[model samples]
Target chain A: MTEDKFKHEEDLFCSGHRACPGCGAALTSKLVTEATGPQTILSMPTGCMEVTTTPYPESAWGISWIHNIFENSAAVAGGIETAYRSFDKRNKEGYMNHEDVNFVVLAGDGATFDIGIRSLSGMMERGHDVLYICYDNEAYMNTGIQRSSSTPIGAATTTSPAGKESFGEDVHKKDMPSIAAAHGLEYVATASVAYPEDFKKKVEKALEIEGPKYIQIFAPCPRGWRHESKNSIEIARLVVETGLYPIFEMENGKITNVKKLKDRKPVEEYLKVQGRFKHLFEKEGGEEVLEELQKIADSNAEKIGIDKE
Target chain B: MTEDPYEDLKISKGAVVKPRTTLVNKTGSWRSEKPIIDHEKCIACGNCEKFCPDMAVKETEEGKFEIDLEYCKGCGICAEECPVKAIIMEEEEK
Candidate 1:
């Protein structure tokens, strides 16, 4: 019960940001920044985190932060890191010299898996010394809960509503860790907000590596997922336990570790709590979708080795 | 010292020059219900502090914990995750 790994002394991510009451992204930001330290330079894109934390006159970030266009957080970080690398460290007037700071991108899945994939790919391929953290809340949550490429199969959203004629999002969640690992980076990992100790350790590990690294964090949205606000952390844990979100790390294109579910729960324990997956229990063919979703989880457990036994 | 944290940087107009100035927002106003902790039953396991989304649960000088109403958004996460069932959410009186 005493999870001390999540403990940190830094106040880099100050409170009073306008995130929702139980925002997983908000908590994720605090945890990531706690792990990265005060010397970290952050690049964010347009997303719930960017909007909520900057309410015009006030900002929650204590460290240096930059948020430009939607698709180029990684691009900007690459440029900033390149600038930092060439600067004279002895020159006290230099904004920030190399070896003094870690360049990082804190982006949403919409900006990451969809709109910004090209720039992200370019940054990783160019081998920029940076870390990119994607707060994947499953869908384009801030913009009225639109269906994103990262949305899970059978989950209903604004664009992929469940009706008599159609089921929810048909496509599976884009295998983004694999995509990031494909760039030949030293580290690519998946994390959840529920297990913040694991998430924090992953951030620290990614920063220690030389080249570009990607850590996609599962950030559950209370409004988007249609669950009780207080259940945010619990739901995040449930998502992992049900095998819907595999928590693992890849180093040099090989699986290193996986967080196995303490209690392997069925999809219903996870799905029934959220309204987005409500169709899976109500509709006629929804049972089959649940089974199919379970199959995906089983395949993930097999492929990722989340369950060794 | 009342000195601005970002004063040295020449950012443009409307730039946030003060670090953590958002503490003035008092997000506790957003709460429709507030958590009331019964210290008699409190185990002080710090689960509330660990899981607080708003960083509102603070360890008191007595080693027990108390909620900082200034930042608590009344998400009830503390009550939900409380190991001792010491926290009870009470409806706010508007």
Candidate 2:
């Protein structure tokens, strides 16, 4: 590996915010802000990222940011992007050059998949020049690990704890990328903090495109996921390698690229490492539970074509 | 930031905080273990700076890496992801 690959830009998501020790979402925001640069304006909703970074008089962001409500960050961003486009139009009419500005929405799964999907859909359908990034930790991490629509099956969250009658989350994760692609967005991708280079590249690519773009990052939370702090990045990688999370892109409603798994690991390998899924290993009918999860990974691998030959 | 936060201001429509003022907070106190990089074995790949959730690891002008104790949360991610295993997390002393 060359040293050039490791070199990065200034931290737009500055330090001194109060994120938990090994927060994958924090790094996800940091890498995203770095890629977007200082010219960008951010609209963040109520989530772990908002709560951790902005506390009263201090904010970790170096760029201009706005915190609206839990369900309207995308709408706010769309409004701001629309305002910037108006400026572009008037400036062109007057033969003036105005500095380019990008409007981005940094939201979490609860806001994106459940509460704010309507607003997000409106933003995308309106074709606003906004890059909406959803940091999916698979649950409502900010509000004591509640379950959201994006929560994967067989994973225990506070609201979806594994028990005799329940097998953690009963429903499968929402296919958010496909939903975004259905809006005919120019770019839609699913990335992970485990692959930093790809994440940054996708952010840059999404910004370069003029229309609306959606990129959901698989951010792991050590606090909510019940994993070792140091294993945050490791578990993020396992999600991609296990085929539980497929990293792919859709351009103009066509699948452009998929990060094919070299040798896809079993769901057991990923589930065994986290405390949330520990019940799957020790509970009654555990093997059946695992089989259900394995089917999810298999179907994902087939649908996304991660096993390309 | 105003040392007397409430003393200086009129009630305005917006809240004003200077950029990067969070640097004033010495977050290093949050660390139970500190990272000490073995410069002799360091390859300067910059992974520590890149992967640090807190952005505490920085490259000095001398082309050397330094972890800003003021902001390093002692997460030990740098040590964990170090390609060359140059960084070791050492227990902090009272």
What is candidate 1's lDDT per residue for A1-309, written digit by digit as tens?
A: 233222212368876788899999998988887899989889999999999887776778888888878998999999999888767544647477677799999999999999999999999999999999999998998899999999998989999998996679998889999999989989999999888889999999888889899999998899999999999989988889988899999999999999976567887899999999998898999998999989988888888877745
- Model 1 sits at an interface RMSD, in angstroms, of 4.2
The candidate maximizing DockQ is 2
TM-score of chain A of 1: 0.94
RMSD to true structure for each model, in Å = 6.9, 6.6
DockQ per candidate, 2 decimals: 0.32, 0.34
Instruction: List residue ranges in candidate 1 displaced over 4 A.
Output: A1-10, A89-92, B1-17
Clashing pairs in 1: none
Q: Report lDDT (Cα) of residue A171, candidate 2.
A: 88
Encode model 1's per-residue lDDT on B1-94: one tens digit a residue: 8989887987665354555657667798999999999999998888888778777777865787888786789988889988889999999995
TM-score of chain B of each: 0.81, 0.83
Q: How accurately is candidate 1 docked according to DockQ?
A: 0.32
- CA displacement after TM-score superposition, residue A295 of candidate 1 (Å): 0.4
**Candidate 2, A1-309: lDDT as tens digits:** 225221222457877788899899999989988799888889999999988888879888888899889999999999987776677777646422223676799999999999999999999999888999999999998889999999888889989998888879888888999999999998999999988999999999999998899999998899898998888888888988999998988899888999997799998888888999998899888888799989989998988899857
